[model samples]
Target chain A: EVKLLQSTDVTGGTFTLLLIGMIGTAVLLFLGTGWVSRKWKLPVALAGIVAMLAAAYYWQAREVWLTAGQMPVIYRYIDWLITVPIQVLALYFFIGTVARPPTGLFWRLLVVAIVMILARYMGEVGFMHPTLGFLIGIVGWLYILGEVYFGKLGEINTKSASETVQTGFFWLRLVVTIGWAIYPLCYFIGSFAGGVDEGTLSIVYNLADFINQILFGLIILYAAAKESATAR
Target chain B: EVKLLQSTDVTGGTFTLLLIGMIGTAVLLFLGTGWVSRKWKLPVALAGIVAMLAAAYYWQAREVWLTAGQMPVIYRYIDWLITVPIQVLALYFFIGTVARPPTGLFWRLLVVAIVMILARYMGEVGFMHPTLGFLIGIVGWLYILGEVYFGKLGEINTKSASETVQTGFFWLRLVVTIGWAIYPLCYFIGSFAGGVDEGTLSIVYNLADFINQILFGLIILYAAAKESATAR
Candidate 1:
């Protein structure tokens, strides 16, 4: 049997931190929608929805971590499976205001994002060779980065007249780049390093998500509010 | 070691049913908000929010039920802990439109509702004696019934002038009385009786929630839509 690290005060504290951050951010995004212009409302609200879903998943995660004294891998993946696509789509909605996205851009990004998550999940669960899954997952993430930063969407975003939109797109893209990179790094260390325990990985994962998920939405909200103020 | 029922096709299918019901209802309630008037919008949308939260919880519950083949009682209570209060508040919001609810009515009902869920939860988890917990839970439920049925809120309902609100109040109270009874019945069977398996109790609980959660919201939506159409 694989040995699991029992929960310590630190891990439990981290989970609580995650829980509060997600719920607080979710409520903020939802309430913040009223302050933004109509066009920005959907993206902001979608982020709120994603945060709400994450908050619910973490509710169970915190309970399991504290009570069962082990991480349930399924909770993390299930959370990503639902929330990640919505986060990606929040970006789609954010840009739809300033630029007409190319045909198939939405579907392509969604499919790739799902594949990225599925690849990592299959690897973690031993359904595929870990190295192969990691490679496929990385490829999927890189494709997304290319699409948002250098591909057709990126071209549209560059050509768009709205400075607010352009600035927001830059930060959102950077988050998907640098902020999301934590996932693969965690995967590598947790699965391949053979030294770190689950508790450490859990805390690291929680912190990464707390930053990425909330920061992604905050960038959009900032742009939306700025745009709204200028328009008014 | 406690024996766990191996997941079968039937149990798996039931979980899928629960998952689909929750998500579908959540989406429906959310989208249905546009059809209601501004006064009724919060309560209708609050129901949607509740359904959304329920969908997230069921997603996790179904995963554990299908894979672990055992009920995680904590998932049920965690779901209730958050969703139940919002649901109670939904009723409070609904009645606020038609009647000036008495002072302390909201807090009293909310506290009793929390007490009800906590008592049963503690009983299930062995934090307290099961019979004593069961009795406290029953007492809490009865107090809520009294508050809504014959206490100040119910008295206001009887004196209300709006036919739609009065009719809606009648059905909503029935749900609280008859629909919510499923919990105590399930708790009694699962805890006190020695015969029923966890699988059986899970199926019962899922079905009960699928009905209670959706039906509670639908009744509000129906009344709100009717009132909106008539007023317009």
Candidate 2:
């Protein structure tokens, strides 16, 4: 039988260091990407997703590390509220960087992100029944997920774009689809059984953010590099 | 401010009749469609989705009508457990009925339906926190929606198939995507607000099943007939 592992203060320190390393790496990459291709939108937006996520993660990690005993759950939600929406915007920029961007896509994506993030926040903060708030949030995530994989990214995948563009879109969408799914799975794990406690949840979340925020950024960087190389 | 609408016993009778009417229609349509197209798989699967949904709805309606005051929520989950998996099959048949069906498509779709439906049941049954259940279900749903719209249906839409096949998939997919979203929305609404009682939820559910089951079947019938005409 699988059991939930209770993390100790030592493990907490290790995770905090990891979080700092993630943030420092993200900042360095963001600055480097910005310098490499300020002219391109995708890389800039990719940098933006990492920037906010790193900030959120770093801040939360510090707060949790400094405090003793059980960490405050609200810190995680605060990090998510600040970073998750920005991540959605990064996805938006993926489509927008292409010429003749779809009309109303930006606002629509933003609305979904805001609704999802806020509804979840409300639930976490006890403004409503957690389940119902979560349901609303799920509804919002469904809308964004539908538009991303089914609607926009599909268009990008099948369009008459060049080989490099198509390759970039294919890999980018794959990364987003696969990597982002881990967040919710981890969420379910945390919420479902008595086995996984807050500390493990934090570790898993921090690790996931490291991948989703940074590894996700790697795809766009490659794409931007390809785009810039051809232009020069 | 929006408030949840409570339903009364008198209204309950009307919805019970509606449920019976829905079941009766689905039965009649199933018989008629079975006679019309035994050779085709899509219509058969469409018939199956309706047949189970009608039976589940019919059983639940009878119990509620007889019991008067209290309702067992498990009946609804039972219904979903039986019907939703079939509904996924209906979606698969939409693509499966086409020439050169994709590899491993059936198992993937089944896995998604099972994951989605079971997670929902666990949440409703209080076996797990509803939020985690909802998230897992959403994950399943997003996967299915992605495949149906962006992945497979898009392929069905663009391929050099006969006009009849394309039209069938077009209408089928639209009905599935738009019509199915409402069930989750209503579910969230019912779960979120105390004002909307189970009766109103049942009424809305019966009404939606009619559209989703019978009305959805009608489209498949047209497509089946068209397929038959071309076959001859």
Candidate 3:
């Protein structure tokens, strides 16, 4: 009998709080982008959004800010936190591509948006079906690789020093994409073909999840750094 | 105690055969697109790839071709069937976008490519986390709606004289996305509010799955029609 494992009460509560914090941060960033875009400029505003999301993710993980299962009211909001921003960013990119926006922040924001969304969603759901999540990771990396290979990444631009500069995060994007790609390949092949035991599967899944979350955090950091450097 | 649903030892030989037949037909249509492109002088080859993937998905759910436990295998191949063509199309589109291929197939193909990939993976993995899959569906549809609103759909050249060119069985996309969205919404609200019953959850899950599969089959039919139309 395959007994369904009930999600831990503590984890569920923590999940809720993390989600609420993430969503609240996303909303603040969205508004901040609008204000900052009108004042300091768009690149700086976009950078702010990336920085805020990254900070929210870090805060969610911090023991000081978050206690396990202490808040159940926030998980539903967290789920949206992980999903809505990605969709918004992707849509923004798609529309930009068609409309030919003056600033090429579209694709960069699209990738960052997707990475953040996936990181948060994976935090919530990746453990549920490790194999499938691994597969999706491969697919996501491949999609990003295709974009980079085709020079689509260059289409995105940053407003720096009153000039539209092409400050694409080549190395950071490459590392993050490669990291996600390899992590999944290792786990899926190890478990599916090697016939690794369940214990190993669990370990690998948690490790991969942790690594993915870290990479996501790093990607955001790189995006902010790249933005600031370009501004200089 | 949640007893495991005992699966009958039904010979899935027929289902397997049907799946192969569908794959074979889809492959042929996929290949047929290449030949048609050459004959029609369509500036790009992605149209064929799209045709092929749509065919595979639409044919995937032939009632005669699936059974219990057989789904995972059927879905695995189906995933490849849809994914490979989309990736190829995306690569070509990326090249076109950067290289300035005479045809404007990049944006439209990109949309279809990503959506196809998402649909394939979501169908396979969404079963485990019904809520997550539903959320993906809503996000995807909203993205598509954004595209439609931006007139991106109209830009896709169906390569046929017909005004109403069917693109895969988007109905499956509609059903799965809508169904999954409803499931998660219900689960989150009910789980949090503590008002929904298990029986309701089970019924919603089963119904969504059934609708998703049925729509999948319909998509295959649409793919076939698309092939025939374009072939003419």
Candidate 4:
């Protein structure tokens, strides 16, 4: 029985570490892309502040997980704080690219930031399942996909009369969108299949989450490199 | 023991009825608001559709509660479905009003529709702990308050070169916001002071919820009257 318990602890610890790593890598990718965008005169640089905070949140959450034997209750609080910036930046990028006479990156980011702040409460109060943390992360991926689809990928050229959409990231966008979509559907289905066993559903959800995050990280890296090269 | 069981049945039956009524009201409010927005050249009529479906989900969830008699099991689903629409519409209305601009009637009716939705969800899920529902409901109320504060509370004249914000509904917005805010805080404090018995928490929460719905319905009626007078 002691051996079994130790093994269980090991598994839980590893799983927690993996989730922390995914969140950290996602934050880095966001900052990296924003850096490239800033170099190109796009307003993405301002949104990078959100990315930095998210990285810090993941770092704290991971530390808590490593030290605390029980799930750190405060991890939820950190989860919420991190979600705010990501949501804001994601929506900012979306609206900035779509605006006919686009407003400054400020308004778009502000709106998204507020929405995310509100969403944080929803998650914190247990209004939605904590697993939603991973789900909300997909918004970042969606923004990237939207930018690529609309050919607004990379730095802005104010001197140019009109902006054109880029096609290089089409396949990358397709893969990410499809992958993120699957995570939610799997979650909904898993909820029913797992029934009253919260542990079972959490395991299934986390495994799918691990796969999704790794793929997401790869996509971000690919897009960042592609956009950087195009800039050169 | 038999009398106690009878009391339980009676309360459960009443809860079910109230839940149905709240959902019915939500659907009507959603449809009515959609019709009005469409006529006003606002493209957010689809958001109204999504909101209505979410209300329907709440409706079904309440039915499950009435039948299942197992609060934990039924509530898990109810909480999930309700949160989606609340979050979705919260973001939708914020962006919609900012983007398309709407008349005073839109904000008023939206508050009503959202309150109705909140009442039903609270009745079913938060009935046992009204403070939770009340706290969640306040988030929605604040969004409307923010709208009014930002001056998105008036009619849009499509032909005009620029739109103007109106503040005629200032008092109405204030009353609704304050009233909703009080429910959660009051109930929470009351529950703590009175001692945290399950039955007591349920009663306080349910009573606060009923008051919220009644206030919401009144706002809708007021909005409808204002809209008619303005049209004439």
- Provide the DockQ value for model 4: 0.01
Task: For each candidate, give the interface RMSD after superposing the true interface residues on Cα.
Answer: 6.4, 22.1, 16.5, 15.5
Could you tell me the TM-score of chain B in model 1? 0.91
Residue A210 displacement (Å), model 2: 43
Q: How well is each residue in B1-232 modelled by candidate 4, as lDDT tens digits? A: 1112244664455455556655565455544543332222111222222333334333443444445442332232233233333333333343343355544545454565456445535544435345555555656556555654553442232222222212213333454466456545544464456645433444444444444443344343334434434555
Q: For each candidate, what TM-score against the reference?
A: 0.57, 0.45, 0.29, 0.36
Score candidate 1 by TM-score against the native. 0.57
Clash pairs, model 1 backbone: none
Pick the DockQ winner.
1
**Please, what's the RMSD in Å of model 1?**
11.3
Model 3 per-residue lDDT tens digits across residues A1-232: 1111122222322322333323323332343332222223333334335434543543444322234422221332353355334433432342232234435545554655466436534644644465555455456556555554443443443322322222224443554465455455544565467855433443343344333333333333334433434544
Stretches of candidate 4 above 4 Å error? A1-232, B1-10, B37-172, B194-200, B207-232
**How far does residue B31 in candidate 3 sit from its true spot (Å)?**
14
**Over 4 Å off in model 3, which ranges?**
A3-232, B1-141, B148-151, B157-160, B167-177, B229-232
Could you tell me the lDDT of residue B4 within candidate 4? 23
* TM-score values for chain B across all models: 0.91, 0.82, 0.38, 0.45
Per-residue accuracy of model 3 over B1-232 as CA lDDT, tens digit each: 3223234423333333334544454354444433432222111222333333333333433231232232322232333333333433333332222133334544555565455434534444443354454455456546544443333332332232343233442343355347545544654565456765543443454344334333343344344445446667
Q: Whose lDDT is higher: candidate 1's or candidate 2's?
A: 1
Query: Which window of ten consecutive residues has the lowest lDDT sum in model 4 chain A?
Result: A1-10
- Native-to-model Cα distance after best TM-score fit, residue B194 in candidate 3, in Å: 3.1
Cα lDDT of model 4 by residue, A162-187, tens digit: 32323322333454467446544543
Clashing pairs in 2: A4-A195
Model 4 pairs whose backbones collide: A151-A165, A151-A166, B130-B205
